[model samples]
Target: MDLQLTNKTAFITGSTSGIGFAIAKALLTEGAVVIINGRSQKNIDSAVKQLQAFVPNGKVSGIAVDFKDPSAMDAVKQKIDQLDILINNVGIYASKSFDKTTTNEWHEMFEVNLMSSVKLSKYFLPKMKANNWGRIIFISSECAQLVPEDLIAYSATKAAIQALSRGLAQTTKGSNVSVNTLAPGSTLTESAQEYIKNQAIIEHRSEEDVADDFFKKVRTSSLLQRFTQPKEIADMAVFLASPLSSATNGAVIKVDGGSIPGIV
Candidate 1:
Protein backbone atom coordinates (compact mmCIF):
# COMPACT_ATOMS: atom_id res chain seq x y z
CA MET A 1 0.00 0.00 0.00
CA ASP A 2 2.98 2.31 -0.44
CA LEU A 3 1.28 4.07 -3.41
CA GLN A 4 4.82 4.97 -4.51
CA LEU A 5 3.83 8.63 -4.26
CA THR A 6 6.78 10.02 -2.33
CA ASN A 7 7.95 13.40 -3.66
CA LYS A 8 5.01 13.64 -6.10
CA THR A 9 3.64 17.18 -6.23
CA ALA A 10 -0.16 17.44 -6.02
CA PHE A 11 -2.46 20.42 -6.27
CA ILE A 12 -6.05 20.13 -5.04
CA THR A 13 -8.54 22.95 -5.58
CA GLY A 14 -11.04 24.00 -2.89
CA SER A 15 -9.15 21.93 -0.38
CA THR A 16 -9.52 24.10 2.72
CA SER A 17 -12.20 21.71 4.01
CA GLY A 18 -14.36 18.68 3.35
CA ILE A 19 -13.53 16.01 0.80
CA GLY A 20 -10.90 18.19 -0.87
CA PHE A 21 -9.15 18.62 2.43
CA ALA A 22 -9.40 14.92 3.11
CA ILE A 23 -7.75 14.20 -0.23
CA ALA A 24 -4.93 16.57 0.60
CA LYS A 25 -4.36 14.85 3.91
CA ALA A 26 -4.38 11.40 2.33
CA LEU A 27 -1.80 12.42 -0.26
CA LEU A 28 0.36 13.90 2.43
CA THR A 29 0.15 10.64 4.33
CA GLU A 30 1.56 8.94 1.27
CA GLY A 31 4.53 11.33 1.40
CA ALA A 32 3.45 13.48 -1.53
CA VAL A 33 4.06 17.23 -1.63
CA VAL A 34 0.65 18.91 -1.65
CA ILE A 35 -0.33 22.47 -2.53
CA ILE A 36 -3.87 23.11 -1.36
CA ASN A 37 -6.07 25.91 -2.74
CA GLY A 38 -8.80 28.03 -1.20
CA ARG A 39 -10.33 31.48 -1.73
CA SER A 40 -8.47 33.11 1.13
CA GLN A 41 -5.11 32.85 2.85
CA LYS A 42 -6.77 32.42 6.22
CA ASN A 43 -8.53 29.22 5.17
CA ILE A 44 -5.41 27.85 3.50
CA ASP A 45 -3.26 28.58 6.51
CA SER A 46 -5.74 26.91 8.83
CA ALA A 47 -5.92 23.80 6.66
CA VAL A 48 -2.15 23.62 6.27
CA LYS A 49 -1.70 23.81 9.99
CA GLN A 50 -4.23 21.05 10.58
CA LEU A 51 -2.59 18.89 7.89
CA GLN A 52 0.88 19.31 9.38
CA ALA A 53 -0.55 18.24 12.72
CA PHE A 54 -1.83 15.06 11.10
CA VAL A 55 1.22 14.32 8.94
CA PRO A 56 3.93 15.87 11.15
CA ASN A 57 6.74 16.20 8.59
CA GLY A 58 4.54 16.36 5.47
CA LYS A 59 5.47 18.86 2.83
CA VAL A 60 2.43 21.09 2.34
CA SER A 61 1.75 24.57 0.95
CA GLY A 62 -1.24 26.65 -0.15
CA ILE A 63 -2.53 28.87 -2.94
CA ALA A 64 -5.41 31.25 -2.28
CA VAL A 65 -7.28 32.05 -5.49
CA ASP A 66 -10.94 32.25 -6.38
CA PHE A 67 -11.51 30.00 -9.36
CA LYS A 68 -14.57 32.11 -10.21
CA ASP A 69 -12.25 34.88 -11.29
CA PRO A 70 -11.20 34.57 -14.97
CA SER A 71 -7.68 35.59 -13.93
CA ALA A 72 -7.37 32.98 -11.17
CA MET A 73 -5.33 30.47 -13.16
CA ASP A 74 -2.79 33.15 -14.01
CA ALA A 75 -2.14 33.60 -10.31
CA VAL A 76 -1.73 29.84 -9.88
CA LYS A 77 0.76 29.67 -12.78
CA GLN A 78 2.87 32.31 -11.09
CA LYS A 79 3.02 30.19 -7.94
CA ILE A 80 3.73 26.72 -9.35
CA ASP A 81 5.21 25.58 -12.61
CA GLN A 82 4.28 21.90 -12.94
CA LEU A 83 2.36 19.18 -11.17
CA ASP A 84 2.49 15.38 -11.10
CA ILE A 85 -1.15 15.30 -9.98
CA LEU A 86 -3.98 17.79 -10.47
CA ILE A 87 -7.31 17.31 -8.69
CA ASN A 88 -10.24 19.42 -9.86
CA ASN A 89 -12.27 19.26 -6.63
CA VAL A 90 -13.65 22.77 -6.18
CA GLY A 91 -17.41 23.09 -6.82
CA ILE A 92 -20.54 24.97 -5.80
CA TYR A 93 -24.25 24.16 -6.12
CA ALA A 94 -27.74 25.46 -5.39
CA SER A 95 -30.60 23.13 -4.57
CA LYS A 96 -33.59 24.61 -6.30
CA SER A 97 -36.26 23.77 -8.90
CA PHE A 98 -34.96 23.75 -12.47
CA ASP A 99 -37.27 26.55 -13.54
CA LYS A 100 -36.23 28.65 -10.58
CA THR A 101 -32.54 28.21 -11.45
CA THR A 102 -31.63 31.43 -13.21
CA THR A 103 -29.26 31.92 -16.16
CA ASN A 104 -26.68 33.48 -13.87
CA GLU A 105 -26.90 30.53 -11.49
CA TRP A 106 -26.33 28.07 -14.31
CA HIS A 107 -23.36 30.08 -15.58
CA GLU A 108 -21.87 30.25 -12.13
CA MET A 109 -22.14 26.51 -11.54
CA PHE A 110 -20.55 25.75 -14.92
CA GLU A 111 -17.78 28.23 -14.32
CA VAL A 112 -16.87 26.87 -10.94
CA ASN A 113 -17.60 23.17 -11.41
CA LEU A 114 -16.74 22.42 -15.04
CA MET A 115 -14.64 25.30 -16.37
CA SER A 116 -12.21 25.15 -13.45
CA SER A 117 -11.20 21.64 -14.48
CA VAL A 118 -11.09 22.69 -18.14
CA LYS A 119 -8.77 25.57 -17.37
CA LEU A 120 -6.52 23.57 -15.06
CA SER A 121 -6.27 20.68 -17.48
CA LYS A 122 -5.63 22.91 -20.50
CA TYR A 123 -2.64 24.34 -18.71
CA PHE A 124 -1.18 21.26 -17.01
CA LEU A 125 -2.09 18.29 -19.24
CA PRO A 126 0.50 19.26 -21.81
CA LYS A 127 3.13 19.74 -19.16
CA MET A 128 2.31 16.28 -17.87
CA LYS A 129 2.44 14.90 -21.38
CA ALA A 130 5.84 16.43 -21.94
CA ASN A 131 7.12 15.06 -18.66
CA ASN A 132 5.54 11.73 -19.74
CA TRP A 133 3.89 11.11 -16.37
CA GLY A 134 0.97 12.70 -14.55
CA ARG A 135 -2.47 12.10 -13.10
CA ILE A 136 -5.53 14.35 -13.46
CA ILE A 137 -8.53 13.49 -11.33
CA PHE A 138 -11.89 15.24 -11.72
CA ILE A 139 -14.13 14.99 -8.65
CA SER A 140 -17.52 14.41 -10.15
CA SER A 141 -20.70 13.39 -8.31
CA GLU A 142 -23.42 10.72 -8.50
CA CYS A 143 -25.85 13.54 -9.25
CA ALA A 144 -24.56 13.42 -12.82
CA GLN A 145 -26.40 10.16 -13.35
CA LEU A 146 -29.18 10.49 -10.75
CA VAL A 147 -30.03 14.02 -11.94
CA PRO A 148 -32.15 14.84 -8.91
CA GLU A 149 -34.88 17.35 -9.68
CA ASP A 150 -33.50 19.90 -7.23
CA LEU A 151 -29.97 19.66 -8.61
CA ILE A 152 -30.41 19.75 -12.37
CA ALA A 153 -27.83 22.47 -12.96
CA TYR A 154 -25.29 20.87 -10.70
CA SER A 155 -25.89 17.46 -12.25
CA ALA A 156 -25.45 18.89 -15.74
CA THR A 157 -22.05 20.24 -14.81
CA LYS A 158 -20.98 16.89 -13.37
CA ALA A 159 -22.10 15.02 -16.50
CA ALA A 160 -20.15 17.44 -18.66
CA ILE A 161 -17.08 16.68 -16.54
CA GLN A 162 -17.27 12.96 -17.36
CA ALA A 163 -17.25 13.68 -21.08
CA LEU A 164 -14.45 16.20 -20.63
CA SER A 165 -12.34 13.77 -18.61
CA ARG A 166 -12.78 10.90 -21.08
CA GLY A 167 -11.90 13.11 -24.03
CA LEU A 168 -8.83 14.42 -22.24
CA ALA A 169 -7.71 10.87 -21.47
CA GLN A 170 -7.98 10.02 -25.16
CA THR A 171 -5.42 12.68 -25.97
CA THR A 172 -2.94 11.03 -23.60
CA LYS A 173 -3.02 7.86 -25.75
CA GLY A 174 0.23 6.05 -25.04
CA SER A 175 1.68 8.43 -22.53
CA ASN A 176 2.08 7.84 -18.81
CA VAL A 177 -0.31 10.74 -18.20
CA SER A 178 -3.85 9.71 -17.24
CA VAL A 179 -7.20 11.50 -16.90
CA ASN A 180 -10.11 10.05 -14.91
CA THR A 181 -13.21 11.06 -12.96
CA LEU A 182 -14.52 9.94 -9.57
CA ALA A 183 -18.27 10.14 -8.90
CA PRO A 184 -18.90 10.18 -5.16
CA GLY A 185 -22.23 9.82 -3.41
CA SER A 186 -23.62 11.93 -0.55
CA THR A 187 -20.62 12.26 1.71
CA LEU A 188 -20.66 13.59 5.25
CA THR A 189 -18.46 16.63 4.97
CA GLU A 190 -18.44 19.49 7.50
CA SER A 191 -21.27 21.21 5.66
CA ALA A 192 -23.23 17.97 5.47
CA GLN A 193 -22.68 17.38 9.19
CA GLU A 194 -24.03 20.87 9.96
CA TYR A 195 -27.01 20.20 7.69
CA ILE A 196 -27.83 17.01 9.54
CA LYS A 197 -27.47 18.75 12.90
CA ASN A 198 -29.74 21.60 11.81
CA GLN A 199 -32.32 19.22 10.42
CA ALA A 200 -32.26 17.21 13.63
CA ILE A 201 -32.96 20.32 15.70
CA ILE A 202 -35.76 21.44 13.37
CA GLU A 203 -37.39 18.01 13.31
CA HIS A 204 -36.89 17.57 17.08
CA ARG A 205 -35.07 14.32 16.42
CA SER A 206 -31.60 12.95 17.13
CA GLU A 207 -28.93 13.35 14.48
CA GLU A 208 -28.97 9.60 13.95
CA ASP A 209 -32.68 9.69 13.24
CA VAL A 210 -32.21 12.49 10.73
CA ALA A 211 -29.46 10.58 8.96
CA ASP A 212 -31.62 7.49 8.77
CA ASP A 213 -34.41 9.51 7.17
CA PHE A 214 -31.95 10.89 4.62
CA PHE A 215 -31.12 7.39 3.38
CA LYS A 216 -34.65 6.02 3.59
CA LYS A 217 -36.55 8.96 2.09
CA VAL A 218 -34.01 11.05 0.18
CA ARG A 219 -31.40 8.56 -1.11
CA THR A 220 -33.52 5.40 -1.25
CA SER A 221 -31.22 3.69 -3.75
CA SER A 222 -28.16 3.75 -1.50
CA LEU A 223 -27.06 0.25 -0.60
CA LEU A 224 -24.87 1.62 2.14
CA GLN A 225 -28.00 3.17 3.64
CA ARG A 226 -26.03 5.98 5.29
CA PHE A 227 -23.93 8.99 4.55
CA THR A 228 -20.44 8.21 3.28
CA GLN A 229 -17.54 9.81 5.12
CA PRO A 230 -15.26 12.28 3.34
CA LYS A 231 -12.31 10.04 4.15
CA GLU A 232 -13.89 7.18 2.20
CA ILE A 233 -14.02 9.26 -0.95
CA ALA A 234 -10.59 10.72 -0.25
CA ASP A 235 -9.00 7.29 0.04
CA MET A 236 -10.06 6.45 -3.50
CA ALA A 237 -9.02 9.89 -4.77
CA VAL A 238 -5.52 9.58 -3.34
CA PHE A 239 -5.16 6.14 -4.90
CA LEU A 240 -6.25 7.48 -8.27
CA ALA A 241 -3.77 10.30 -7.98
CA SER A 242 -0.90 7.90 -7.43
CA PRO A 243 1.30 6.27 -10.02
CA LEU A 244 -0.20 2.97 -8.88
CA SER A 245 -3.40 3.81 -10.77
CA SER A 246 -1.74 4.15 -14.17
CA ALA A 247 -4.12 1.70 -15.84
CA THR A 248 -7.30 3.45 -14.66
CA ASN A 249 -7.43 6.18 -17.28
CA GLY A 250 -10.70 7.45 -18.84
CA ALA A 251 -12.89 5.66 -16.29
CA VAL A 252 -15.69 7.21 -14.22
CA ILE A 253 -14.97 5.24 -11.07
CA LYS A 254 -17.77 5.42 -8.49
CA VAL A 255 -17.28 5.44 -4.74
CA ASP A 256 -21.04 6.06 -4.33
CA GLY A 257 -21.99 3.26 -1.90
CA GLY A 258 -24.13 1.67 -4.64
CA SER A 259 -26.54 4.60 -4.95
CA ILE A 260 -25.85 4.43 -8.65
CA PRO A 261 -27.41 1.13 -9.65
CA GLY A 262 -26.72 -1.19 -12.60
CA ILE A 263 -23.43 -2.48 -13.95
CA VAL A 264 -21.42 -0.54 -16.51
Candidate 2:
Protein backbone atom coordinates (compact mmCIF):
# COMPACT_ATOMS: atom_id res chain seq x y z
CA MET A 1 0.00 0.00 0.00
CA ASP A 2 2.96 2.30 -0.20
CA LEU A 3 1.71 4.60 -2.97
CA GLN A 4 5.35 5.27 -3.86
CA LEU A 5 4.52 8.95 -3.64
CA THR A 6 7.01 9.96 -0.96
CA ASN A 7 8.73 13.27 -1.79
CA LYS A 8 6.50 13.86 -4.78
CA THR A 9 5.22 17.45 -5.06
CA ALA A 10 1.53 17.96 -5.93
CA PHE A 11 -0.51 21.07 -6.70
CA ILE A 12 -4.28 20.82 -6.27
CA THR A 13 -6.49 23.68 -7.45
CA GLY A 14 -9.33 24.92 -5.23
CA SER A 15 -7.99 22.85 -2.37
CA THR A 16 -9.07 25.14 0.44
CA SER A 17 -12.25 23.12 1.06
CA GLY A 18 -14.54 20.34 -0.09
CA ILE A 19 -13.27 17.41 -2.18
CA GLY A 20 -10.15 19.27 -3.31
CA PHE A 21 -9.08 19.74 0.30
CA ALA A 22 -9.84 16.08 1.00
CA ILE A 23 -7.62 15.02 -1.93
CA ALA A 24 -4.81 17.30 -0.67
CA LYS A 25 -5.01 15.64 2.73
CA ALA A 26 -4.94 12.16 1.21
CA LEU A 27 -1.93 12.98 -0.94
CA LEU A 28 -0.08 14.43 2.04
CA THR A 29 -0.86 11.26 3.99
CA GLU A 30 0.92 9.32 1.23
CA GLY A 31 3.97 11.57 1.84
CA ALA A 32 3.52 13.95 -1.07
CA VAL A 33 4.49 17.63 -0.66
CA VAL A 34 1.14 19.30 -1.30
CA ILE A 35 0.40 22.82 -2.58
CA ILE A 36 -3.16 23.79 -1.76
CA ASN A 37 -4.83 26.58 -3.76
CA GLY A 38 -7.84 28.82 -3.31
CA ARG A 39 -9.18 32.12 -4.70
CA SER A 40 -8.74 34.00 -1.43
CA GLN A 41 -5.63 34.40 0.67
CA LYS A 42 -7.65 33.94 3.86
CA ASN A 43 -8.98 30.56 2.79
CA ILE A 44 -5.60 29.46 1.46
CA ASP A 45 -3.85 30.38 4.72
CA SER A 46 -6.55 28.70 6.80
CA ALA A 47 -6.32 25.53 4.71
CA VAL A 48 -2.54 25.52 5.00
CA LYS A 49 -2.79 25.76 8.76
CA GLN A 50 -5.38 22.97 8.90
CA LEU A 51 -3.29 20.72 6.66
CA GLN A 52 -0.13 21.47 8.66
CA ALA A 53 -1.94 20.29 11.78
CA PHE A 54 -2.88 17.03 10.04
CA VAL A 55 0.53 16.36 8.48
CA PRO A 56 2.80 17.95 11.14
CA ASN A 57 6.11 16.91 9.64
CA GLY A 58 4.79 16.73 6.06
CA LYS A 59 5.54 19.54 3.61
CA VAL A 60 2.47 21.62 2.82
CA SER A 61 2.09 24.98 1.09
CA GLY A 62 -0.59 27.25 -0.38
CA ILE A 63 -1.19 29.52 -3.35
CA ALA A 64 -4.07 31.97 -3.77
CA VAL A 65 -5.13 32.49 -7.36
CA ASP A 66 -8.49 33.16 -8.91
CA PHE A 67 -8.50 31.23 -12.16
CA LYS A 68 -11.38 33.36 -13.35
CA ASP A 69 -8.93 36.20 -13.81
CA PRO A 70 -6.52 35.81 -16.71
CA SER A 71 -3.90 38.02 -15.05
CA ALA A 72 -4.23 36.10 -11.83
CA MET A 73 -3.61 32.79 -13.64
CA ASP A 74 -0.40 34.27 -15.08
CA ALA A 75 0.69 34.99 -11.52
CA VAL A 76 -0.17 31.44 -10.51
CA LYS A 77 1.90 30.01 -13.37
CA GLN A 78 4.87 32.11 -12.28
CA LYS A 79 4.59 30.78 -8.74
CA ILE A 80 4.59 27.09 -9.76
CA ASP A 81 7.99 25.95 -10.96
CA GLN A 82 8.01 22.16 -11.32
CA LEU A 83 5.56 19.60 -10.04
CA ASP A 84 5.40 15.81 -9.93
CA ILE A 85 1.61 15.89 -9.89
CA LEU A 86 -0.83 18.52 -11.15
CA ILE A 87 -4.49 18.19 -10.20
CA ASN A 88 -6.95 20.43 -12.07
CA ASN A 89 -9.63 20.31 -9.39
CA VAL A 90 -10.90 23.90 -9.44
CA GLY A 91 -14.44 24.39 -10.86
CA ILE A 92 -17.64 26.41 -10.56
CA TYR A 93 -21.28 25.47 -11.19
CA ALA A 94 -24.71 26.98 -11.09
CA SER A 95 -28.02 25.11 -11.19
CA LYS A 96 -30.68 26.84 -13.23
CA SER A 97 -33.07 26.32 -16.13
CA PHE A 98 -31.37 26.09 -19.50
CA ASP A 99 -33.15 29.25 -20.58
CA LYS A 100 -32.01 31.07 -17.48
CA THR A 101 -28.31 30.35 -18.06
CA THR A 102 -26.67 33.35 -19.67
CA THR A 103 -23.81 33.37 -22.15
CA ASN A 104 -21.62 34.99 -19.52
CA GLU A 105 -22.36 32.19 -17.08
CA TRP A 106 -21.35 29.59 -19.66
CA HIS A 107 -18.15 31.49 -20.36
CA GLU A 108 -17.38 31.79 -16.66
CA MET A 109 -17.81 28.08 -16.04
CA PHE A 110 -15.76 27.17 -19.10
CA GLU A 111 -13.04 29.62 -18.12
CA VAL A 112 -12.69 28.40 -14.57
CA ASN A 113 -13.32 24.70 -15.16
CA LEU A 114 -11.86 23.93 -18.60
CA MET A 115 -9.53 26.75 -19.62
CA SER A 116 -7.70 26.77 -16.28
CA SER A 117 -6.69 23.13 -16.74
CA VAL A 118 -5.65 23.78 -20.33
CA LYS A 119 -3.40 26.65 -19.23
CA LEU A 120 -1.84 24.69 -16.36
CA SER A 121 -1.15 21.66 -18.53
CA LYS A 122 0.31 23.84 -21.25
CA TYR A 123 2.86 25.20 -18.80
CA PHE A 124 3.67 22.06 -16.77
CA LEU A 125 3.30 19.14 -19.19
CA PRO A 126 6.50 19.97 -21.02
CA LYS A 127 8.44 20.09 -17.78
CA MET A 128 7.02 16.71 -16.83
CA LYS A 129 7.79 15.31 -20.28
CA ALA A 130 11.39 16.42 -19.92
CA ASN A 131 11.65 14.69 -16.55
CA ASN A 132 9.87 11.61 -17.93
CA TRP A 133 7.62 11.35 -14.86
CA GLY A 134 4.42 13.06 -13.70
CA ARG A 135 0.75 12.64 -12.91
CA ILE A 136 -1.99 14.96 -14.21
CA ILE A 137 -5.45 14.37 -12.82
CA PHE A 138 -8.62 16.22 -13.75
CA ILE A 139 -11.57 16.21 -11.37
CA SER A 140 -14.64 15.74 -13.52
CA SER A 141 -18.21 14.87 -12.52
CA GLU A 142 -20.81 12.16 -13.26
CA CYS A 143 -22.95 14.96 -14.69
CA ALA A 144 -20.70 14.85 -17.74
CA GLN A 145 -22.43 11.63 -18.75
CA LEU A 146 -25.81 12.35 -17.20
CA VAL A 147 -26.02 15.90 -18.63
CA PRO A 148 -28.39 17.24 -16.01
CA GLU A 149 -30.88 19.71 -17.47
CA ASP A 150 -30.25 22.32 -14.83
CA LEU A 151 -26.50 21.89 -15.08
CA ILE A 152 -25.94 22.04 -18.82
CA ALA A 153 -23.04 24.48 -18.54
CA TYR A 154 -21.33 22.52 -15.79
CA SER A 155 -21.85 19.23 -17.61
CA ALA A 156 -20.34 20.69 -20.77
CA THR A 157 -17.25 21.76 -18.86
CA LYS A 158 -16.84 18.29 -17.38
CA ALA A 159 -17.22 16.65 -20.78
CA ALA A 160 -14.57 19.02 -22.13
CA ILE A 161 -12.18 17.85 -19.39
CA GLN A 162 -12.52 14.20 -20.42
CA ALA A 163 -11.51 15.10 -23.96
CA LEU A 164 -8.69 17.36 -22.80
CA SER A 165 -7.30 14.71 -20.46
CA ARG A 166 -7.27 11.97 -23.12
CA GLY A 167 -5.71 14.25 -25.71
CA LEU A 168 -2.98 15.29 -23.28
CA ALA A 169 -2.27 11.68 -22.39
CA GLN A 170 -1.64 10.97 -26.07
CA THR A 171 1.29 13.37 -26.01
CA THR A 172 2.98 11.22 -23.35
CA LYS A 173 2.84 8.10 -25.53
CA GLY A 174 6.09 6.40 -24.38
CA SER A 175 6.79 8.61 -21.38
CA ASN A 176 6.17 7.82 -17.73
CA VAL A 177 3.84 10.82 -17.41
CA SER A 178 0.11 10.00 -17.28
CA VAL A 179 -2.97 12.18 -17.65
CA ASN A 180 -6.40 10.98 -16.48
CA THR A 181 -9.80 12.17 -15.36
CA LEU A 182 -11.83 11.07 -12.33
CA ALA A 183 -15.60 11.57 -12.43
CA PRO A 184 -17.21 11.47 -9.02
CA GLY A 185 -20.93 11.45 -8.30
CA SER A 186 -22.81 13.24 -5.52
CA THR A 187 -20.36 13.41 -2.66
CA LEU A 188 -21.38 14.35 0.85
CA THR A 189 -19.08 17.32 1.39
CA GLU A 190 -19.91 19.96 4.00
CA SER A 191 -21.60 22.14 1.38
CA ALA A 192 -23.69 19.22 0.13
CA GLN A 193 -24.78 18.42 3.69
CA GLU A 194 -25.89 21.99 4.16
CA TYR A 195 -27.78 21.89 0.86
CA ILE A 196 -29.63 18.77 1.87
CA LYS A 197 -30.53 20.24 5.24
CA ASN A 198 -31.97 23.35 3.60
CA GLN A 199 -33.87 21.27 1.07
CA ALA A 200 -35.35 19.13 3.82
CA ILE A 201 -36.61 22.21 5.63
CA ILE A 202 -38.10 23.67 2.46
CA GLU A 203 -39.88 20.41 1.64
CA HIS A 204 -40.96 19.85 5.25
CA ARG A 205 -39.30 16.43 5.31
CA SER A 206 -36.55 14.82 7.32
CA GLU A 207 -33.01 15.11 6.01
CA GLU A 208 -32.98 11.33 5.56
CA ASP A 209 -36.13 11.52 3.49
CA VAL A 210 -34.62 14.18 1.25
CA ALA A 211 -31.56 12.03 0.69
CA ASP A 212 -33.73 9.00 -0.05
CA ASP A 213 -35.69 11.03 -2.58
CA PHE A 214 -32.51 12.08 -4.32
CA PHE A 215 -31.60 8.47 -5.03
CA LYS A 216 -35.13 7.15 -5.57
CA LYS A 217 -36.17 9.92 -7.94
CA VAL A 218 -33.46 12.34 -9.01
CA ARG A 219 -30.62 9.84 -9.23
CA THR A 220 -32.50 6.65 -10.03
CA SER A 221 -29.48 5.01 -11.62
CA SER A 222 -27.40 5.10 -8.46
CA LEU A 223 -26.60 1.73 -6.90
CA LEU A 224 -25.04 3.12 -3.72
CA GLN A 225 -28.34 4.83 -2.84
CA ARG A 226 -26.56 7.60 -0.95
CA PHE A 227 -23.91 10.26 -1.30
CA THR A 228 -20.31 9.10 -1.54
CA GLN A 229 -18.05 10.53 1.13
CA PRO A 230 -15.30 13.00 0.17
CA LYS A 231 -12.69 10.59 1.60
CA GLU A 232 -13.91 7.83 -0.68
CA ILE A 233 -13.28 10.00 -3.73
CA ALA A 234 -10.00 11.25 -2.26
CA ASP A 235 -8.67 7.70 -1.86
CA MET A 236 -9.05 7.03 -5.57
CA ALA A 237 -7.40 10.37 -6.43
CA VAL A 238 -4.44 9.52 -4.19
CA PHE A 239 -3.97 6.20 -5.95
CA LEU A 240 -4.14 7.78 -9.38
CA ALA A 241 -1.56 10.39 -8.33
CA SER A 242 0.90 7.70 -7.23
CA PRO A 243 3.58 6.03 -9.35
CA LEU A 244 1.63 2.81 -8.80
CA SER A 245 -0.94 4.08 -11.34
CA SER A 246 1.56 4.58 -14.15
CA ALA A 247 -0.36 2.27 -16.43
CA THR A 248 -3.66 4.11 -16.06
CA ASN A 249 -3.20 6.84 -18.62
CA GLY A 250 -5.74 8.54 -20.90
CA ALA A 251 -8.66 7.05 -18.93
CA VAL A 252 -11.82 8.33 -17.32
CA ILE A 253 -12.19 6.51 -14.00
CA LYS A 254 -15.54 6.84 -12.26
CA VAL A 255 -15.95 6.94 -8.51
CA ASP A 256 -19.64 7.57 -9.11
CA GLY A 257 -21.17 4.84 -6.93
CA GLY A 258 -22.78 3.29 -10.02
CA SER A 259 -24.64 6.50 -10.77
CA ILE A 260 -23.20 6.53 -14.26
CA PRO A 261 -24.65 3.48 -15.97
CA GLY A 262 -23.23 1.15 -18.65
CA ILE A 263 -19.85 -0.56 -18.65
CA VAL A 264 -16.80 1.24 -19.95
Q: Which candidate's lDDT is highest?
A: 1
Q: Which residue ranges in model 2 land beyond 4 Å of their true spot?
A: none
The 10-residue segment of model 1 with minimum total lDDT is 67-76
lDDT of candidate 2 at residue 178, scale 0 to 100: 98
| TM-scores of the candidates in the order shown | 0.99, 0.98
Off by over 4 Å in 1: none
lDDT for 88 (candidate 1): 97
Can you write out model 1's per-residue Cα lDDT over 1-264, one digit (the tens) per residue?
Answer: 789999999999999999999999999999999999999999999999999999999999999999888789899999989899999999899999999999999999999999999999999999999999999999999999999999999999999999999999999999999999999999999999999999999999999999999998999999999889999999999889988898899999999999998996
TM-score of 1: 0.99
lDDT of 2 by residue, 112-147 (tens): 999999999998999999999999999999999999
